[model samples]
Target chain A: MMEATNAELYRLVLTDAPYVIGAYAILWIAFVVYLSMVLARMMRLEKEVDLLESAVSKRSGE
Target chain B: MKQLRTAIVLVAIGGLLTTAAFLMAFFTAEVQQFGTVTLEQEVDTVFPVAPDQFQPPAGEGIAYVRPWFSQKIFYFHVPVAEASFLVLIISAVFAIRFLTSKRAEFDTKSRIAMETALVFVVLTMITGVLWTRASWGVWWEWEPRLTTYFIMMLMMIAYFVLRNSIEEEERRATYAAVFAVVAAINAPISFMITRVIPSNHPVVFQPGMASSNLLPFIIGQIGMLMIGYGIYTARMTEERLRERVEIAKEALEG
Candidate 1:
């Protein structure tokens, strides 16, 4: 009887595990993705300014 | 640079705390029973229907103490939802400040805060749906709390749309600020709807929680707030960088 009860509880846990896991996964993934986007934007902006400076300097020399 | 470093530090600490809370919620905290399940009517549940232990008789069955695995969701959901609301109010406060002072910085701050609020709100909605599915056996429902929160999300989206539709900076900022304040109004309404009106969404507030449960919940709340602040600050730094680039570009052209 005890083993059967434990088995039932385990089944319930497995059933609900997806939703719980999904929630945590979504939360963390969203945070990491957003942070990465911000970092990517910063890098691109820095690169753009660098290229812009070089282009202007090259034109001045020409 | 200094601000970005501080933001990173906060995010690291916040991430660790939230992760700790998540772990504690599963291993240390005791799950609360919202209510009992009865076999009187056909109901969808994760629990075994009329298990041997819960089986009363063929004709009649009493209410069973079915464990709610979804109760674990409460810790994270409550904190994220509250964080969203707090950030919305922050946006509105900055919006009001911008309207009064006519400062560009305040407008930017309001916009960033709104962005952060939207992110948290989306996270809340996702977790909320999962909770509903796990606990209530529904993927979506037109309940009061859910409906109010959906409206709040729409309002936040509309605020940004209003900002983009207008080309003039000052006019756009003014309109978005007004919309921000209006959207902030919905935050409280949505939060209170679960208590004020009859709703299936469990109210985690009002004491009576075991210290084990409360510890993870409190930690999650503080962690979420710190995360929200870190995201806000980092985004602000990025905005400042963009402004500098714009200034430099114009200087070159001139």
Candidate 2:
């Protein structure tokens, strides 16, 4: 009875493992994707700001 | 500049804490007993055929408490749900402030917070769906909490639609702020629906949770809040950079 009950625990863990792993995987992936997006946007804005600064400096020089 | 640094630090700390909570949930926390169910016939589950808790009669099984339903998902689900609710409130509060102050910064803050709220809400829904599948053996159900939370998600989506439809800046801000406030009302209602109405959804925040469960839950909640704030602040930093670019464009034109 004891050994079988323990096996039941193992079976339960194995059975539910997919849903548990899936939930956590989705969360971590979402964070990674979200952070990547923010970083990409920031980089684009930096490039634009650099271009604008040079243009402004060039204009003032002229 | 300092805020961005703080945000990074918070994200790092939050990530570590949540990871620890996840580990503890599986390793240290005792498997919670959800009580028993009386079955007219045998059910196919990973549970033992006849544990001590089982009541015996042929084809009539009194099942033992099954940890298979919510034990694992509860850690992630509850934290994300609470964080989403908190972030929604933050967005609504900023929206109200924007309305009163007529400040563009407040509007930016509110908008960024709304984006964060939406992200958390999506995560909550995803985790919740997984839980329902494991517990109820279905991908979707029209239970009270699920229905109300679905409405909340739709309202949030409509908020962005309303924002995108407007071209003028002030008008867009005004409309979005109002919409944000309206959409945020769903968070509290969705949260309380399980308690107020009958729900198959387990109500987890009552006084009787074991220390084993409560400890990890608290850690997970704190970590999620920090992560939410970190994300919001980081997004705000990006918005500030965009504003700088806009200012430079105006300077060139002037």
Top model number, lDDT: 1
- Tens digit per residue, CA lDDT, model 2, B118-148: 9999999999998888767799999999999
For model 1, what is the C-alpha lDDT against the true structure?
A: 0.86
**In DockQ terms, which candidate is top?**
2
Clashing pairs in 1: none
In order, what fnat does every candidate score? 0.40, 0.49
Question: Which residue segments of model 1 deviate by more than 4 Å?
Answer: A1-5, A49-62, B34-64
- Candidate 2 residue B78 Cα shift, in angstroms, is 0.8
Q: After superposition, how far is residue B108 of candidate 2 from its true place, in Å?
A: 1.0
lDDT tens digits, residues B1-254, model 1?
A: 79888888988999999999999998999865544455554444445454466565665644445577888888888899999999999999999999999999999999999999999999999999999998888999998999999999999999988998999999999999999999999998998888899987777787687999999999999999999999999999899888877866775686
Lowest lDDT block of 10, candidate 2 chain A? A1-10
* Stretches of model 2 off by over 4 angstroms after superposition: A1-9, B34-54, B58-65
TM-score of each: 0.88, 0.89
Q: List the residue pairs that clash in candidate 2.
A: none
